[model samples]
Target: MPSKSSARLAALTVAAACSAATTLVLVSPAHAAAVRIHDVQGTTRTSPYAGQKVTDVAGIVTGVRTYGSSKGFWIQDPNPDDDPATSEGVFVFTSSTPKVGLGDSVTVSGTVSEFVPGGTTSGNQSVTEITKPTVTVLSSGNAVPAATVIDARSVPAAYAPAGDPAANNSVNGLPLQPSTYALDHYESLEGMNVQVADTRVVTATDPYTELWVTVKPRENASRRGGTVYGSYDAQNTGRLQIQSLGRTADFPVANVGDVLEGTTAGPLDYNQFGGYTLVANQLGTLRSAGLERESTEKQKNGELAVATYNVENLDPSDATFEAHASAIVNNLKSPDIVSLEEIQDNNGATDDGTVAADVTVNKLIDAIVAAGGPRYDWRSIDPADDTDGGEPGGNIRQVFLFNPERVSFTDRAGGDATTAVGVQRLRGKAALTVSPGRIDPADTAWKSSRKPLVGEFVFRGRTVIVIANHFNSKGGDQGLTSHYQPPVRSSETQRHQQATLVNAFVKDVLDTQKNADVIALGDINDFEFSGTAQILEGDGELWSAIKSLPRSERYTYDYQGNQQVLDQILVSPSIRRGCDFEYDSVHINSEFHDQISDHDPQVLRFHP
Candidate 1:
């Protein structure tokens, strides 16, 4: 509930906007009959009357976006039709800034259009719009329509469209069940007045002045302040985006678990970024979730700990060394051997011909020692130029950092760039001829990506084979917010093959040594329920260590309002059979604005 002062503030703001709107009256002939905004918007992402000339489209101006190349005002029909499937509001593109006022009831004449925000090359969907208009102010001071309540109880529990969640499946064209599916629920409310109360913030406010929240907290949610993104099969459907349309200052900077305590009333919209967004102006007061940073348990003697971390492109230019060291040492507990992804070459993002990471690794190792961690030794093969995907010239690739005081790295001869290491069955046990060798480097699955780097390590006089990897990222995949009925995921094709090749290699090692004590870990860039994970865990030969934890607790990253897993560790059957392992996601990063990296490192502690 708003205080009298706050309520007075809201009234004053609305009054001020109406006063401004009253001053910008324009007169035009009302020769043609008026058309409702919903008729022009139709029921689809594109307007049914696009490219056609429409006259006398009348609505109250809801907002005026004066900045940006796509300057426009959103207009809504005060007397909306009884169709829940159609949008009552539409954006009127004025291209050049126009003298428009909020709450001004005006009659407009323009060519109906379907305008893409970033244009066609960007693959962004189009917005229903009225362009090249003739405007006439019909009236002023008319009350805005009441907001539709969209609280947690109002949202459907089921997210993602039913049937085939992927694009072009047999059931992709099935009719939407708006009452049950969240995608349909949001789509039905697109471009309409919608509001949510007492919502819990799900993601940190991003650079785009947008943040996600769950209107109603999921049941039995931990005091942790965030909700599980669940698996790919069961995405968090309760999430909603609140985007600031009037001012960036209006949107608060928040972390996962923070609460937006007041009501946010605005027009619902569909865009390229996220599926549905509430374009807001008068947002509610924020409530603190009281979440704190956490660190994992320390690794003790005889308990070998292995971990994976994505350093978020650390380089000499970025002054994140000590902070990263603190996270690795104090937070992640300084595992005996850690597989590091995205270790950049010297000079970082500079596209010079330099491929050496000696200085970069040296600085990080020095930072670790300075931060009371072990003096670590590292191993890696820098990628060819910018062939490895990441910041240009960063030469990002998988690297191994081992605490020599606790473990020894096996560095035999004959391993280099572009050389693939084959598994040898020596005395019925899997062994690599050369240590720190790439797996199937020449294979197409690893083209233009970081190839798996396998190495042997002796911990407490027992040898174990570990493979480090960073698979191709999900860059070009259409977002969940796509206007398409079911979103496309074209990025998975390559990853599926990459998984197959990796799985085959793992099987070879298992067949040679049934209890190989093998561990394959890094940022796989796919969900646990995804096909990529399925292939990697083929025939129960390898098991994802993160799965060892409760389903609700398995997350290494936070996106939107859902805590999800993007980093994972898969160990061989021998390790799973023993059941002596314990895994921790180490919530040192993510869920916070000030963190060392974007990803939370995962650790698996066990005796091999």
Candidate 2:
């Protein structure tokens, strides 16, 4: 036998010769070669004979894994043209710049090599290494160039789920795919800029920095056994970051009928407080394409109109206001008075240096103008000035915006005004007094926690006491217990307390104004079936404006794999008569929550 050194030298010589031959084959002037991701074959594509200098390979990213402190990601290309049952011929190792996700179609090019694969305890196929593969994403639309945007819902069952986890409970009826890849992948994208599109519903818009958007893959796609599905929660949902561009002095900076576009770079991640969700990073507007305009004809009759939606956090920023102003004005059924939650204020002052309280109020006023509606002159009880606790910038509360053209500003009431039952422990409390003269109390049920902003609005011929509530969250089980409470230990004993307080207030208001119509709306923070909601409905006197419709039409928030009825528009029997309230839980926030705000708005349209 030859000496050890001599043997090694011989092996090297053989490898060098093989490499040279491979180079010649690739450099030949006469032969032009290309390989589709689906066509590559063999059990192991190793260097020398295995390391072919393929120019390009096209296929969808079936799987992806990241390792080595953001060094790069490993992508799997399981092409249909390849061995279907086994991922044998698919590319095992591909280098990326850390912005790739599963189901994305891409074309990669570079010299392929073989090395030992990592992260496996069992001894398996050890081939790895793809040198300098230039990746070109093939997603559709100009949002991300070269990236192939897949519907994800269009992916096969083996790769994507057909319906949400809660709905179908499997990958097209099969067991749910392990979320190991999603969890890890989300961690990698945290704070990084990314974009996603899907048809889910939005839930919450608190803690303004990170907006949570939930998406639910359609169910029909799964029943057909051709598509895959995913659910929304802290994990798998997509996310977008909220950011502001400069202000414009135009009448309608961006109308409700304009498509919003923008880009930013930062880590993107997912968290599951109660649902799987996507959080965006470095979000900003790219452009606004005008959408189809709705007929602006106002209803001839005087009716009590109500609507609800997750505005994705209408912050006190000019760019955000402009981008969404038109949609809020036009897409909405043009209700006489609009009940809004998640109206944010700047820190201590408005962007223009006005008092933060005044700044927040004015930003909304300006947004109404941009949306092509009459000026929204309104008021809130608290000035959003409390800085000791609660959400930063005391201005992060629910507010009512009314079109002065339809309703006049009469008297303001509610918010910190009453020391009623369970109201002492609450910190930021107050209610706005509006025209038509109605009294609303800060929903004292969540006094120990984040109190609900409640107020009464007097319409043309009726008194509508509207309670805007932000109740105990379903993020954790804390709200489920009878003694559950927040830090202050106020009246938030259980999730139901928030609803209970609202129920009591509504009952009291109805008792006082027996013939008056009461409309309650806002982010209740709990689902429809929960005990908290039962209190508000009390003996069927209060009706869920959306429940009168089909099951598929009742959801206002998407959680985990199930769509839960969180945000709602509850109306007393008095208002339900002449007011055929049309309520729509718009899915806009579901698509862009991570970038905008988490909670969707609830709009009520009815004859006053």
- Candidates in order, TM-scores: namely 0.90, 0.50
Model 2 poorest ten-residue lDDT run = 478-487
Model 2 Cα lDDT, one tens digit per residue, 1-608 = 34434543342222111211111112222222276433333321222335677765554443333422212333334323323222222333333233555455555666665432221111111233344556666652222212122124322222223333462222112222223222222222221223445322222222222232222243322121111112222223232222221122211123211222333322222121221122222233423332222223344456555554445434555366654565567656456666666555554323332224457567756776867766776655443244212344434455667766676544533235333322111122222333222122344443434445554455674445666666565432321101111112222255666566667766665655555566778777655654666787997558777676555555554433334567888888776775565666654443232334444555666654
Predicted structure with the largest TM-score when compared to the true one: 1
Q: Write down the TM-score for model 2.
A: 0.50
lDDT of each: 0.77, 0.42
Error of 1 at 310 (Å): 0.4
Return the clash pairs for model 1, or none. Answer: 275-481
True lDDT of residue 355, candidate 1 = 84
lDDT of 1 at 404: 88
lDDT for 279 (candidate 1):
82
